[model samples]
Target chain A: MICLAAFIVFAILGIFSATHRRLAKQAFWCVLRRVTFKPCQASIGEILKGKIVGWLLRRKSRWAGWVHRYFEVFSWIFVIITLVSTFYTVKGAYFYIRYGTCNPEHPEQCLISTQAALEKGVINPYYCNDK
Target chain B: MVENSWKSQFPFLMQKKNGQPLIYFDNACMTPCPIPVLEAMEKYNKEFFSCGGRSNTHFGRDVDDKVEETRELVAKFIGAGASQEIIFTKNATEGINLVARGLNLHAGERVLVSDREHNSNLIVWQVLQKERGIELMILPSKSDETFDLAGLEAELQKGIKLVSVVYSSNLDGYTLPVEEIVKLARKYDAFVMLDGAQAVPHHAVNVKKLGVDFLAFSGHKMTAPSGIGVLYGRLAHLENLSSLLCGGHSVKDSRYNGFELEDIPARFEAGLQNYGGIIGLGEAIKFIKQVGFDFIAKQEFELNYFITRELKQIGGINFVGVDDPKSRGGIVNFYHEKMDSNQLTIFLDESANILTRSGRHCVHSWYNSRGVKDSIRISSYFYNTIDEAEKLISALKKILGLV
Candidate 1:
C-alpha cells in the first residue's frame, strides 16, 4: 500500500508538471532525497542521471536533460508537502490518543476528542446542537 | 443554496485543508458522519457505556433496551417482519460471511452471482466453492455493465441453491435489477441474498417488498460510524441457518456434552456488540428519514447529471457502464487517455482539494475480464454540490490539458 501511494504521488506530480514545471521538479527532487529543507542545491540533471535516464541520455541527452531540469523544483515541493503532511498526521494521532483531539485549540473538529470531552462533561462549543 | 445548506450539516465538510475547502466526493467509500449521528454515538459513550444483552445491572439493562429499540427501528426501516430478524455484525463483509458460511449447502449445489459483485460478495462464495465443492456460477453482464437477465435465468434453470448478488456495482454504480432477479430465483426455488452495502445508503430498500431472503449493509456508508452492519434475513431462514460464531450470548443452555443455541438474531451475534455504532445507525436512519428519500434521490440525480455533462465536455475522458446516468446511482467512473487514473485522483486531492477514489474498486473481476486495469471513480452523495462537481471538472481539465 505504501508503494502504491508513492507511485500515485509521483504519477500526479508528473501530470501536474505539465502546467507547473518548477513546482513539480522541486517536489520530485525533495522526494528522491527524502529531505524537507531547501531543495535549490540539487540539480535535475544529477537526479535524472539514473539507468533509464542514462539510456535516454545516450540517444537524446538534450531532451532527457531538459525534461529532468523542467520537473526538478516542483518535485522537491511535492516531497516537502508530503513530509509535512505525514508529520502532521503523526502529531494529530498522538494528540488524539493523549488528549482525545487532533487539535488542542479546536477539539470539536475531532470526533474522537469531541466524544471524549462530552463523556467527561466538558462543554464542546463546536458540537453544541442544543437548538 | 440547497447544496450549501445541506453541506453544513456535515462538520467534516466545513474543514479546510491547505487553505482549500474539502470537496469530498468519495461517499461510496464511506460517508462523513453528520452531527446528529456523531451526537447519538456520543450519547451512548457518555451516558450508557455498558455491555448490552448480558448484564443484570441497571446500566446494562438500559443499554440492552436501547439496543433492542435500535433493532426495532432497523427492522421497520428495512421492512423486516420482526426485530429478531436483524443481526448486527461488524460490517457488511461480516454480515455477508455470516449468511454465506451459515447456509447449509451440500456438495454440487450452486450459488449464482453477478459479474460485477464486490470482493466481499464474490470472495465468500469463492471460498465456499473451494471448501464445500459447490459450483459458483458468475452471470455475465452486457457491454454497458447491466446484468443480462436472460443469462441469469439460464443459470437459475441449472438448479441453484442460492443466488447472491450485489444490489449495486461499486465500480460503476450500476444498480442490478434485484426485484426481477429475486422473482426469478423464487421460481427456481433458490434463496436470494442481496449485498446492500452500496444500495441501502442510496436507495430506500425494503427487504419484504423486494422479496429477498437476505440483505446485508454497512452503517458507515449511510452517515453512521464504522464497525456496525446489519444482516436482515427471513425468520424461517434465520431459524434454519447455523450460527457462524459461538460464545456467551449465542447459547441458551450448555450441558457437559451438548448445548442449546439461542434463537435467531442473538444466536448470530455472539460477542460483545458495538453499541455506540448501532445507536448511531438508528440516528442515521432518523436523519435519513428527516431528509427523506425524495430529496436524497433528487439531489443525487442532479449532481450525477451535472458531473456527467461536464465530464463529456472534456476531451479524452471515457465513462464506464451504461450511457444513461440515471441507470447508475450517483457514481461516475471514468478514465483519461492522457494520464493514469491514480495520478488524476492524487492531483484532484492534492492540487484541487477534491477527494475521489481510483482503481478497480474491489471489483477486479470486471476489470480482469475486460483487460482494463484501473479507472477513477467519483461518488456523490446528497451533501455534495454543483460547485464541487465544477471544481472536479476544472481540475481534470487542468491536469489533462483540456483547459
Candidate 2:
C-alpha cells in the first residue's frame, strides 16, 4: 500500500509536469530510466533540481540549491513516514488476524474480538474485567 | 445536550496513530464497523463456520437459519414488505448493475437519472444506453443543488421507462426529493430505482412509504463489512426482474437443456454468498436500531452545522452545494481557489492526523459538465463530535495558511 501510494504521488507529479514542455520531457525520461534500470547521463537529483529550481538557480544559484536540498530532505521524510505508517498498519492487521486484537494489552481495542463477544452475548475474556 | 457516548462504541474512533488521535471524517466513503457488527462476523467464522443456505448438516442449517433471520431483520429495518424483497449482492454497484441489466429495456426506451448521481448509478445507465439503444435522460438539478422536480416532471411527460437516481448526493450530501420523484415517475408508469448508498446509513429509509420500486445500498457505508450490500425491490419487481447471475443455489433443478429457478430473493442471490458479511450487516442494522435514526441525525447535524459555520469564516473556500447546513446531509464539500484539493487533503492527514477525501468524488460528470474540477469532502457521522469538527476547522485554517 505504501509503495502504491508513492507510485500514485509520482504518477500525479509526472502528469502535472507534463503541462510544461521542458519538464514533461525530463519527467517522462526519468520515468523511462527508472522503469528500464538504465543509467542516465545526469543524476535524478540533479535533473529534478535543475528542472524545478532552474529559473531560481539562474537568478540566485546558492538560494535555489539550498531550497532544492530542503525539498529533497522533505521528500525523503515523507517517504519514511509513509513506510513507517504502512509497517504499523500491516503489523496491526497481522496482530488482529492472529489474536483478534491489534494490541493485546488492551483487548477492548480489538474490534473483531469485541464485536464477536458482543454478538455472542459473551464478555471479551481479556478486557471484560477491566474497568 | 446530545450525548456523544456513541464514539465509545467504535474502537477505531479511539485509535491513535503517531501519538495523535485519528480524526476520521471520511464516513461517506465508508465507516469503521462497530464492535457488535464485528462480533457477529467473528461469531459466524469461529463457531458456525459452514456454507449457508445449501447444506443439510447441523452447522449448515444453523448458518442458513441465521442468514434468513438476517434477511428478515434487514427487510424490517428498511421497511420492505417481505424478506423476499431483499437480495444480497457484493456491493451497491453490483445491485445497480443487476437492476439496470435485468430490467430488459427495449430500444428507444428512456431512463432518467439526476445530474448528481455517483458513477455507479450513472455509468450503468450509460452502458445500457450504449448496448441496448436506450436513451439516457439527464434530470437537471436546481441552482441550490436540490433535485429539479419540475425538470423531472417534464422528463416524465416524455415517457421514461425508468427513473434511477441517487437518494443522496455523495458529493454534497444533498438529498433528492425521493418521495416526490417516485410519485412523478409512477404517474408516467415508470419504474423508480434509488441508489441509496449514501442515504441508507444516515437516514431511516422506508421503501414502502417512499413508494420506490427499488433501493440499493452498501452495508460497509453503514458499519458492516465491505463485501455485503442489499438490493430491495418490491415483490412484483423482484419476481419479474431477470436474474443477473445463475448457477448453484439460484436454481431449484437443472439440466443440460433447461433449468428451474428458485423464488424471488434466492433466484437473484447466486453462489455461496458472503455469509460473514451478511451476518455482520444483520448486527449493523441492530446497532443502528439501538442507536435510533433520530439520535444519529441529531449528532451528525451538530457536527455538520458546527463545521459549516466555521468553514464560512475561512477565506477562499467555496462550498459545493447549498449554503444552509440543514439543506444537506452530514457532508461538507468545498474547494479553495488558491489551494489544490489533493494537497490540502494530504496536509490535513500529515499535519493533524485528520483523514478526508478530495477529488471529483465519483461524480465526475457533474464536475465535468460544470467545468469544475476537484473538491475536498468532509463527511461526519454519529461517532464524530463537535471537538473533532473544531479540530478539522483549525487544521483547515492552518492548511489554508490562515493561521
Candidate 3:
C-alpha cells in the first residue's frame, strides 16, 4: 500500500530529478510485484518508512512511535487520499474540457469559469448546467 | 582521528550536515578527492587546457609532459618495468574490456575466473563465451569463502589459457592468494590478469615483484577524479597485444588503405587523453606517498576492527566477508535478518549522515548464487575517524531496535 503511494509521489517527482526517477522505477516494480500477488520488493516504501520515521524520531518522538506502530494503516490512508484526490482531479479536468467549467453543477466556484462567466454577464450555475 | 592522519586533508570530511560531520564509509566505490588532487586538476584546466600528444603549441607540450610524468608516476607506484606499460583509461571497466578484447581468444579456448568476480570482470568473459564460443570456467571457492587453490589447480589442469580474478573481493574483502594464483598460472603457461581496483589504494602491489601480466585500477578509487584509470601491462605483452581503439594518437603512418600503429602506451591510448584527470591522478599518487601505506593500513585496521567488534554485539546481523578485520582491511559488510539492506542503508543515512553502499554492489552473481537478496557494505579509508565509526554504530543500533 505504501509502495502504491510512493509510486505516485516518486512518479510526480521524477519529472525533475534523476535520483527520484530511479526511485520511481523501483516503486513501479514494487507495485507490479504487489499487483501480481508476489512478495512486495518494496525497497522504495521501506526507504520512505525509514525517512519518515527517522525524521519524526528526531523532532517528535511520540508521533514517531505512533507512526512506527501503525505504518500500514497510514499507508492505506495515504493511498486512499491519493486515489480520492486523483479521481476528483480527473473528473474536474474532464468537466472543464467539455463544459468550460471545472464543475458543471457549481460553475461559479471555479475561478476559470467564474471569470469568463462574469465577463459574459452570465454568473449563474444554470449557464453551464445546460450541458 | 588518528595521529598524523590524512583525515583533515580531505575536504569532504571538513563538510558538515545538520551541524555534524558527514560519516563517509563508501570508499570502496570511490574516495573523495583531497585538496591537492583538486588543485592539480584545477591548475591544469585553468592554466593550460590542451590536448596531449596531439597539439604542437606550448599548452599541448605542457599537457604531454604532465601526461608522461603521470605515466611514470603510475609505473613507479605499481613497480612496472617501464612507463610505456601504463595505459590511461576511463575506468577499470574499460581497462578490463581493453584486455578481454585485445587477447583475441579463439573458439574452444578456456579462461578461468573465480565464483566471486565482479560484473565488469565476469560479463566480458560471458559475452566472449556466447559470441566467440570460448570455454569459461568458474573456479569455486572453499566453504569458508576464501580462494580455493586446489580448485584453481584443477581448472589449470584442464588447459586454461588465462586466469583473471579480483586481487581483493569487493563483496567480502577477501584477498585472493594472487602470488600463488600467478605461480600456478605460470606453471600452466597461462596469462594472468589481476583486477586491482580494490587492492591498489589499500595495498602495496609491485608488478615487477608480484609478476602479473596485466593489472587494472581506477583513479577515482584512490582520491583522484573520475573518468581516469590505469591499465599496467607487461612491456612484451602490450607490444604483442592488439589495440582496441584507432584514429588520432593510435596511428603513426596513415594512408588511403592501411596504417601503422603507434608504439606501446600511445597505441592503446587512441583518442584525446584526459589531461586534467591524469594530472589529478598523479597528484593523488604523490599525496598517497606522502601519507604512506603503513599509516593507511593501520588507520583502516583500527576503524574496521572497531566497526566489526561493535557490530558483533548487535545481534540479528549476518556479517559478510571473512570474520577477521585485519584480513578484510577497510571493508566490513553485513545485513539484518529482519530488515532489508535498502531500508537499513537509508535509515543509516537518515539517522546520521553516514554514507554507505547497499545491495549486491555489482557482484550480483555471488549473492544470487548464495540466495542472499541484499547486503549493506561499509568500506572505510584513512580519511574516516573513530567518531564516525561510533556514530555509525549508534545509528545502526537504533535502526535495529536495540536502543
Candidate 4:
C-alpha cells in the first residue's frame, strides 16, 4: 500500500516540520488500518499520491499519467528500497564497531575506519581487522 | 474585459501571485473584498475605534451612528420591514442557531428541512431534535435534484411547525422555489425561514415582499469581512425570539439582583461587536448596489456557460444538479470519472495558481445518500473574468494531457 511508503516519507519529513508531523500521524493511521486488513479509509494515501502526481503534472504530463496509474507499484518499490537500505546501514554499523572496519571483507573500502588504523602507524591497514 | 465589471475594484486580482496569475473560483466559500470595503473598515478601525453605545464622546457617538446606519443598510439591502428586524451575528450559522433556540418548540412539534442543506442549516435542527424532543423531517429533492414542492405540501399537510431551507444550495447552486414554499407554509400556518447565505449575494432578495418570516446570510460571502452576518426577521417574530447570548451590552439596565434585557437588536447582540466588519459589510453592500445584480447575474451566466461547456469536453466528467449552467447561479459543480476531484484540483493548482474547492463540501448527508465521495465546486463572481475561465480550462486541459 502507498500508505506505508508515505508513512516513511512523512515520518522523515516530520522531524523538522509540524505540517508534515500532522500528515505523518494520518499516514500512520492509514498504514495501521491497512496492516490490520482493513481499508486505507483515512484517504491519506490518495492525497499523497495526488500531491506527488500533481507536482509531476506541472512539469511532465506523461510522468503524471504513469505515476498516477501505478503509484501502488512505486510505493512497493520504495518500501523494498527502504528495507534493503536499512538492513545494510545496520550491518555496516555493527561491523564498524566489531572489527574497526565497516566492510570487513574489503577494509580499504571504509576509508574513515581504515584511516583511523593507519593513523596508529600500522604497516598494513588490514591489521585493524586481522588483529 | 467586460465593461462595467468590478475586476479592477478587487486588489487581490490586480497582480500575479508567485509569477503565475491567480484565478480564485471559490466564491461560495468567501468572496474577496473590494478596495472600498477594505477602506471603510480601515477608516472605522483607525478613527472611531472606541466602544460603541458606552461613551458619550465623539468617537463612541460615531461608532454608534455607523453601527445603526449599517443596520439600516442591511435591512434595506434584504428588504426587511424595519431596521429593528436586523440582528448582527458572527456569521449565518449563529443566526440560524439563534432561531433554532429562539423558537422554543415543544415535544412532537415538527421542523422540516431539505436534504441538500448546508451543515449550518442541518446540524442546528438535528441538535434541536435531540434536545427539545421535536420531530425533524427531511424533504427529499425531485429526481432532477430540484426542490420538490409537492413534497413540501405533503409534509405541511402532515402538520409541520416550521420550514427552514437553503435559498440556494451551496452544494450545487440549485435554488429552491422560495415563493411556493412560503405560500405553502402560510397556507398551513407554519413559519418559514431561509438560509440565504448563497441567495442574498447574487439575488435581489426582498423578504418583506416575499413575506418570509426569517432569513440569514454572511457578509464575507459577499464582499465584506468574515466576522459580520445578518439575521432578518419580522419585528413581531424577533420580539418573540429569545436571546442566545447575554452579557455587557445585551441588557438595558442592571441591578445587584436583576436586569432588564435591551430592546430588539441590542437584546440579541451582546458584546463589543465587530464594528470594523459591520462597516466593511455596509460598504460592500453599497458597492453591490452600484454594480447591480443584473450585471452580476449576466457576468456569472457567461462565465459558467464557458467553464461548463469546456469542462464537459474533458473525459468522464459528471455534473451535479442540472446540466444547464445559467440556472445553477455562479457554481459549476462536478467530478471526473477518471480523476479524483481532489487530485484534479491539486493538479490544476500545481500547473497554475487557479483555485477551486473540492471534497465533500459540507453536505455530507446528500453526498452520503447519493454515494458520491467528493465533488469539485467553482463559482464566478462579477469580478471573475472570461480570461480566468479560459485559464481554468487550459489548466484542466494540461492536467488531462489534452492540450
Interface RMSD of each: 13.7, 12.9, 2.9, 3.8
lDDT string, candidate 4, B1-403, tens digits: 4644577888886667447877889999999899999999898888778898788899999999999999999999988888999999999999999999998899899999999999999998888878989999999988888889998999999999999999988988878889999999999999999999999999899999889999999999999989999899899998889989999899989999999999888999998899899989999999999989998898888898889999888878889876678679999999877667776776677567788988878899999999988889998888888988998988787776632
- Writing each residue's lDDT as its tens digit, candidate 3 over B227-307 gives 999999999888778877887999898999999998888989988888899999999999999888988899889998999
TM-score of each: 0.77, 0.78, 0.92, 0.89
Q: Write model 4 residue lDDT over A4-119, tens digit each, in one string.
A: 87778788789999998988899999889988998664278877776787677667778888887788799899888877876887788887786677776666677756666434
- Quote the positional error of residue B297 for candidate 2 in Å: 0.9
Pull out the clashing pairs in model 3. none
The complex in candidate 3 yields a DockQ of 0.43
Where does candidate 4 stray beyond 4 Å? A1-3, A33-48, A83-131, B1-5, B15-18, B401-403
Instruction: State what share of the real interface contacts each candidate retains.
Output: 0.00, 0.00, 0.42, 0.42
Please state the error at residue A46 of candidate 4 in Å: 4.4
| Model 3 alpha-carbon miss at residue B33, Å | 0.6
Interface RMSD of 1: 13.7
Runs off by more than 4 Å, candidate 1: A1-131, B1-4
Which lDDT value does model 1 have at B304? Answer: 86
lDDT, each prediction: 0.80, 0.82, 0.87, 0.86
**Which lDDT value does model 4 have at B397?**
79
lDDT per residue as tens, model 3, A58-94: 5675676678778889999999998888788888787
TM-score of chain B of each: 0.97, 0.98, 0.98, 0.98
Q: B1-403, model 2: which lDDT tens digit per residue?
A: 3757877888888888657798999999999999998888899889989988778899999899989999999999999999999999999999999999999998899999998889999898888888999999997778777789999998899899999999988988888889999999889999999999999999999999989999999999999989999999999888789989998999999999999999889999889999999999999999988888998889878888888888889888899976778867899999999866765676566557788998899999999988887899999888888888888898677556521
